[model samples]
Target: MKEIYLVGGAVRDKLLGYPYSEKDWVVVGATPEEMESEGYRPVGKDFPVFLHPETGEEYALARTERKTAPGYSGFVFHTSPDITLKEDLLRRDLTINAIAEDCQGNIFDPYGGRQDLQSRILRHVSDAFSEDPVRVLRVARFAARYHHLGFTLAEETRQLMSSMVQEGEVSHLVPERVWKETERALREPSPHIFVEVLRQCGALAVIMPELDNLFGVPQPKQHHPEVDCGLHCLMALEQARQLSEDSEVLFAALVHDLGKAETPTEELPRHIGHESRSLPLIETLCDRLGVPKKHRELALSVARDHTNCHRAMELRPTTLMQLMQRLDGFRRPQHLEQFLLACEADAKGRTGLEQHPYPQREYVLQALVACNRIQARDVMEEGITGKAIGEALTRKRVSALKQFKQQFTTQDKTQ
Candidate 1:
């Protein structure tokens, strides 16, 4: 008899009426030869996985796992005709992900996954959940993704995660795995929750000590009513979520303020020149995690120039042009826009200013438009050569920027 069950996120998402990206199935009591004979392409190496001929969905034989050593790679898996779906589900990380649905649409949840899902709780499937340190990150990611749905980690699951951290399991996590989880977390609706959950479970210290160190650092109460650097980071991430869906903006918002953590204790609530201080920190983090170039570049720009972006209206035309050049605004306007969004998140992340308008963004953007209006070809057409042309181009752009600033002031006065 052939027995196949829709499993993992497919079942959980269908039950919750959410759209899932892919479907995974567990085949019980099905031999490899029989699966291949039915036109299922063999794809598994460590276990029996095949692709359906028509749907291209993954179907893996029911398997059970045991901890042979440390880390996620140390697991010893057993797959045979005797392995039950219950046994396979027991090896899963979260209860909500362990539920299975049959072809006849019957639900098979022996571990109370349905109850946990209905309760909107993220509960561990078993003690073995702690065996895989990656599961800690997965739980936090789930909290971030489902935060809008009122889903939270179960106390037992949190305790297990904390234990895993204490046992040094998180220290063995590879950089690529950490980055993969973090990148996904940054795209979640409530990315800040991902950081908070990891910090709560002690995984942040192991995976990202620099980020963890920001927790107790002080900030000026007048400018940042949140008062703590870590909370400010969370607020900024939330603001970024509201401003843009671009993960580059989100990543920049999260790490742009990290330099405040390195501020001297004698400085107290004042963080002068923290922008420059953030540059090395950002580089080290990106290097450590192998962060993508786009995210790394935007984060560096936000860290180095966010202060200038916030003071857009007050800057001189020359200063504005220099700022634009620093961000390579002429070549990559999209990155500049992302930089502005990150800066806006920083300005509005304060306790009472979340909904405040950030017109500085438009102010700087207008300056860019003014500069672009003085095209190099137009400057070249003016009969100059060598270094003279460069100087002339700069002069023309500066004059345009000044006029643009005056026009902005005039419009503001009339409005």
Candidate 2:
């Protein structure tokens, strides 16, 4: 009873050969009061949990409890000196996470977790899995992480998730928590699993009702052999997931064309101005998910300017300079790379766009490079405000800047 054990993700990740640094300890013979006696501080506001003062590690006292509510919000926790470590393992989300390891590296697998791990299946520890709708998101995330590893959802768990969605357990989840899980899943090696799970469980409609409208909306046959707006969106989201796990970029990509579902037409299959229309919705979603203000603004900018990549090619030098100024001297190579990647992913995800080479993209990228090399900030430091610079150039100067460098135009090149 004196022995404590490491359990859950630490053990599961260890077996999978993933770096398992964060450790969760379950004390077998300790109560919260006993842990307090050992100088551990109780910290779990939502549940009974504590932290070790020296290591700052979390320690949840072992307990055996029963449900008082019908769902996850209904739990009644009971901790005791008599409860064993096995009791705590049984109450976890999945069999893979239910396994425990002691300090000496001895593993305890009372629920055939090792076998399920070997088989690459995520099975719930008990019927209690149905009680927590959040498990649905976790399962989806696990599917994304373990898909290449050959993991599949267990039948009972899948059925339970479907049932939970049908029962509207999704509303029990807070927006921030759900967004955190969804964003994490999107950042995975493949987030298609997350989408598929959301589609199957009916949870996607709960959070993103706008997407549900795209289900059967067909696209123009000439461009999209994929058939519908939803399918195209799914493909785009998959591309986004593969491109980067940057939460803001990924979220923006996923909903960048959301307005298309409402604005689809026979002539231009994807609704024009959909990017602009989606900004407010994305902002609301970002707020609901508790994303930072800076990230929200960046994502909104990506969505708003997604269509502007083409327009950038036609910009006169003054206009180009204005655009660069608007970007506030974003001179870093990685900044340009991230913007181009986001633009390219958006472009590649669409169909029937003019095949004209993205000259503006190339031009802007080169301009960004030049801006860095010449230290555009130094130009600004030389008493050149963006408005001041814009006023300095004449119509002729603007035209010349847009065109090839003629020596006659070189006169205006100086600030």
Candidate 3:
């Protein structure tokens, strides 16, 4: 058996001038036994995966076969010496991902994948695409990533996704997998494509039912020129993308105002306590999605504390310091930057409306910097224990530190 080269994504990314990351190699000529004989250690128990001894790169000796099971979870494998690289490429999710390069760098285009890539179209490998519900999410994510590349879902692929959604195949997908795709899509350069794809495929309802409520929900004309809450959210998401916010912050921004769709409103629509309402909702959703606890906390913090920005600005320095102190001494530059990004996304979301009541953005940033300095230099380094700091603040020094912060701010303003 010849070792046919079938390098997939790395080749395509190279052709597109994008950075190639995480090279995954699939070997056709080697069996599990042969791989072990060649000094490749078996890694996967359920599947045949190996690691090269020299490069430490993972290589999967996956065989090709038709599915015997109904859903993506049901697949039969055939690991024989006869499997070709062409057969393996045909099983991929999309045409753009199916094209392979050989050892000599000769590109193989058996299924017209190169043409699809050139045309920037996202067509399924075959009608069997519906077998894998995850492909539906993958298509949406690819749309988000390659929209500027002019990629459009093929008609058949769209129909297949619609059918899968209608047939309840979406429920077969694990929450973690769905959340992974959704998070990735939200972090794309433009998530509008992904949102639009979901809108078309009816997959949003299964993935994020909160967002589904946004469809056709009217917003006040004055503030939102876009009319519908869903459209407005799309616009806000686009703005968030432009700001280059982190995935967690961006996801929070997308869903921060979701409560508005559920809460009752009149002609002058209002979502009182939407930020607070969204906090628990996000927590539950993130939990279901199996988001990491730290990330969930950060996103929930952004969602919950997002509404406090305007209020925080009006408080005295001491009150602000007390609030910051309540944040449990988690002082870090990255934390502050993330907070600023969340605040900025929230403000940008409210553009075209009444002016925000918060102190100017620059002023708040300066205050944050000053507050961080005080906490890092004085409060943190005090060698006096937490109990001591707590006692000092409660009794003798609270008022003094407040006075010091005030003086510092006043001096800063003067400078």
Give the per-residue lDDT of model 3 (tens digit) for 385-405: 756765544433345446655
Model 1 misplaced stretches (Cα beyond 4 Å): 386-388
Q: Write model 2 residue lDDT over 327-391, tens digit each, in one string.
A: 45353445445555566556556555424244555667765654444443545666877766545
| Candidate 1 C-alpha error for residue 45, in Å | 3.1
lDDT per residue, candidate 1, 1-415, as tens digits? 6799999998998888877899999999888899999999999887789999999999999998878888868877788888888998999999999999999999999999999889999999889898999999999999999999999999999999999999999988988899999999988889999999999999998887778889999888888888999999999999999898898999999999878889999998899989888889899898988999999999999999999898889999999988998899988999899999999999998899988999999888878888888877887788888788878888888899999999999999999
User: What TM-score should be assigned to candidate 3?
Assistant: 0.84
Q: Which candidate's TM-score is highest?
A: 1
Per-prediction TM-score: 0.98, 0.83, 0.84
Residue 159 in model 3: lDDT? 90
Candidate 3 Cα lDDT to native:
0.70
Error of 3 at 292 (Å): 1.5
Candidate models: Cα lDDT each:
0.91, 0.71, 0.70
RMSD of 3: 4.1
lDDT of 1: 0.91
* Backbone clashes under 3 angstroms, per model: 0, 0, 0
Worst 10 residues of 3 by lDDT: 353-362
Off by over 4 Å in 2: 69-74, 221-225, 264-268, 310-337, 350-362, 371-390, 393-415
Question: What's model 1's lDDT at 405?
Answer: 91
